[model samples]
Target chain A: MKHAAPTRTLLALYTAMVAFVLIAPTVVVIPLSFTDKASLTFPPSGWSTRWYENFFNDPAWTAAFGNSLTVALIVTVVATAAGTAAAVGVSKWSRKRMAKAAQMFLLAPIVVPSIILAIGVYAIFLRLQLLGTLPGFVLAHSVLAVPFVLVSVSAALAGFDDRLTTAAASLGADRWTTFRRVMLPLILPGVVSGALFAFVTSFDEVVLSIFIKSPYLETLPVKMYASVTRDTDPTIAAAATMIMLLTTVIIAVGLLSMRRKKIA
Target chain B: MPDKTPGAGTRIDVKNVTKRYAKSTAVDDVSLSIEPGEFITLLGPSGSGKTTTLNLIAGFTELTHGSIEIDGQRVDHVPAHKRGLGVVFQHYALFPHMTVAENIAFPLQQRKTPKAAQAALVASVLQTVGLAGYQDRFPKELSGGQQQRVAFARAMVFNPRALLMDEPLGALDKNLREKLQLEIKRIHQDVGRTFVFVTHDQEEALILSDRIAIFNNGRIEQVGTSADLYERPASLFVARFMGESTVFKAQVSSNGSDWHMDFHGSTLHGPVTSTVPGKGALVLRPEQLRVAESRADAPAGSAAVPVQVIQNIYLGSGHKYELRLPDGSTGIVRTPLTERTSLRPGDSAYVHWPAHQGVLLEDNDLVSTT
Candidate 1:
């Protein structure tokens, strides 16, 4: 499928344009965070690390950062456990139509508009008197994060042989022992990736968090949204850069570990 | 029975076992008693309930009717893991993530065997399967035959009451399959445990089994030793399934002393071994048939049919001839190299067999829908 010279040139140009468009915003934010200017202006006239200093020193930013990390970590654990169980159960269901319906239900959060879910959660949280609470934010973010876990774990289970479980049982292993000894070690790669996805989903959530956040409990994304409207500073760019770096490192680690497992 | 020696075999009794799905019956009223220390094979084509019967006995499948007993104790309520039977699947379902040593040690660990004893048992069983010093390798690293041997070692390490195998050698090439068949037979002899093997290859079944049970249409058509199945099949389906046969569909008429059948226009006489009336077939094995140059050269008092030699295949120890009978149906005749005849393609000859060598079986080939 080699292309003509002119066609190959055109294809390379198109690919480069798409890549620049996708990466420009993130790339620009990194440089803007190092600017000496107080405002977030691209191609800054001077360079400094004052914004990074402000991002680390400010109590509001620090609290929001800590809150975000805690929620993301907790959501990762909860969502990974629930989603892996759901995936295994759905894979073993003998009634295919019912299994398909259950899968669609688990994935509905990813397909439905975020605003609709935000409004629905806000109304329910208001009635429960949980509008300004940590549990409220954790609950909403977990609802959005679980689908990522489910998809990754289900993909892993798809390649797993169902006969291995039968083989385990014939060798005198009970259901729990078979799962812990045979099934888990095989599907661990999927579970790890799902946990990382869950962490990023909760860490970056804003729309649902905006509906549920309180003055006392604001995640990093919610605080960033408030900052952009109330102030014009390069500190927000520093925060964005940090978030990008954290997720990229997490994803890279996940991919490397999965690749190593495959090689082994 | 409860005090039977460990590592010794246990008798399995399946009484009128039937497994019925919603649409069709997989195993229908199949009853067989397997003796301890006997190697029995469930021989049938695909979907003929041989594997299903093995699964039923393994407790992986539930029997819809009747019961199964191990050592005279009913086990219909037992789970697969609790039944303590070793099972080797066709694909050698070894745990891919585990090393060979760990895979074989899994059953011992499940039984709460001590750590030191588990290692000793795993090593001993691996050596028994002739896979010593290959313990650290993963299943994917081993060849297909090696993986199957590892599977065999894993299934046997726990000293189960009996061993059940479902076409364990089916995934290998013909040469490896034959080689492993001998290894499996030797292992069976060394263990002296009851083995219930399932296979569709009749030659493999005959080579390995102490007794073979022929399954057809979810029923046990016949159960006998290899010689009993090959020489004296109870029905036409058994005769056709066991080996190659030359069949003559005829109307069976019996006198007080002998049985007679009309083949084309000639009358053939056989001993009245069974009172098979009406439609029947005179089935003779290929070796039982010989090709003579003419009717005058056929043996005295032998039933002979005029045929044209279509092709004569030279076997190493004998010659096999493809024959065209008078009714256009093909027949086969095998003669030893010592008795090589002048028969060649396009030559007129008579395919003859001793009257006593022909088995007069009921014409019930249609009994098996598959």
Candidate 2:
């Protein structure tokens, strides 16, 4: 076996160093979250799980956590259904020009600045008198999450062999039966991965949540933001750690399922 | 394996069917009547409308004009799903997620067959396709040939009125394809169903079909039994497509029932009569033409043309001698290895064939690029 050259090794070390610098804040916060001291200090004194207990015992934190989970669940269901349908429709468009245009329009949320999108959504929700409601947050988050689902489902659709549908039709299956038996199973992984992505997008979203949040209806991110600005509480680090852990688990499951599908 | 499903074979009538795209016609004014229990092959090159004609009959594509009838009932307006035609695509199109048993049972399930009946039918189909114990293997787990067998089983399990195959064996290796071709022939014989097969392979068509329809440029040039198309092709295209042959340009003249053609300068008489006087092509199959040492040794009354050999190719069972004709055109002749004649490149010889063996195609040139 041949070892890498010195220059290549240096380049790899540089990339790892850059990655560490980018994620340093999160790494520091995790350990601080376990600190026994009252203030947010890393490697300070002994370690404890007091902040985690604080997160679990407090009613405000628990309410924010519940609110975030509910909104993310709603967004995941709405976005996956609408986005998967849109992907199938877009994949079926005969005219290349129309399909390309529709794809660009559907993916506009990903390219637009988040703050501008938040303000625009806030304005629309206000006019609809849904600003502080659960539906408003769910709808607003779904707007951002839909693009991820659409992209994931579209990628799956790209590799689909349409002749199976024709074969199913010829074999005495109606259109709906063909979709349910053949098309759905083939693209299920894409639909599932897209739904997970939509969930994660809604759960960690803060910019839009900040704009639409009411005092009575705060998501985890909005509450964390308020805690950081109002008080120098270390419990914010615990909240960040929990959100990170949730996203990590979701992503890990998504990757594992995708790998299993590939192997199968 | 017994096929208990009713109505295995159905007569299909395609009356002047035409399918036109915006830019060009895929199938144009084509008509063919396929008998029940007959295996008819649509043979042509890619983009020559053979597959399009199959699709039209299968109701996958709507006809631009004319009608199609299945078992004497018009079905041009029926959708593909309601047509109940068994179609096997070139790529197999097996559902990757389904086990072989489930795939074969799909049509039965759709028609609401009882679970016990579906299981029994799937088992029977698996046995019929020679994959009796592969019930739980998914499509992705099977080899290409096994997948194709599963596809055939799925298409046949439902006992559709007619089976339409579009280049089903095009993807396999040569040995596997030949093996599967024999399997298909056996299955067709056992089932006794009408099969409309499409392929670009002339040899496969000749070997497997009772009748072969040769398509060229969106139209069927000719449709007949393998021997009919091979021996008495109606047009220049059919003669060129069916097999290898050498052509000579000649001028036709007739005396009532007898006909004679004037080659470059030599005159030859044939048993068939020519109704008109004009230039036509004299098609001679390589097997019919023999190489003689001299014009004097050639068969009496046979058309003999002197040529010089360009190359001799050893073909295991025989030898093929490529020659340059008197008119400076190329010709090929296949001779058995047992023949005593010794020929080599640059050797001078006369190629002779009986007058009755040559076919005169009117208004045809000796060569065609299409």
Which candidate tops lDDT?
1
> Residue by residue across B114-204, what tens digits does model 1's lDDT show?
9999989888888888999999999999999999999999999988889999999999999999999999998888878888999999999
Q: Going through the candidates in order, what fraction of the true interface contacts does each contain?
A: 0.86, 0.98
Show model 2 residue runs off by greater than 4 Å. Answer: A1-12, A34-54, B1-8, B251-260, B269-277, B310-322, B332-345, B363-370
The CA lDDT at B315 in model 2 is 91
lDDT of 2 by residue, B1-370 (tens): 3353333578999999999998999999999999988999999989999999999998888999999999999999999999988988889999988899889999888888899988998998888888999999989889999999999989988888888999999999999999989988888888888999999999999879999999998999999999899888888788888898887766777777777776666776776644554776777788888888789988788888888989888898888878887677788889888854777889998888886787778755545322
- Where does candidate 1 chain B have its weakest 10-residue lDDT segment? B1-10
Candidate 2 per-residue lDDT over residues A1-264, each given as its tens digit: 565799789988999999999999777888988888888876768898999999999999999999999999999999999999999999989898999999999999999999999999899888998887899999999999999999999999888999999999998999889988999889988999999999999999999999999988989999999999998789999999999989999989898988898887
DockQ of each: 0.78, 0.75
What TM-scores result for chain A when each predicted structure is judged separately against the true chain A?
A: 0.97, 0.95
RMSD per candidate (Å) reads: 2.8, 3.1
**lDDT at position A149, candidate 1:** 93
Per-candidate TM vs. native?
0.94, 0.90
lDDT of 1 by residue, A50-133 (tens): 988998899999999999999999999889989999999999998999999999999999999999999999999999988868
TM-score of chain B of 1: 0.95
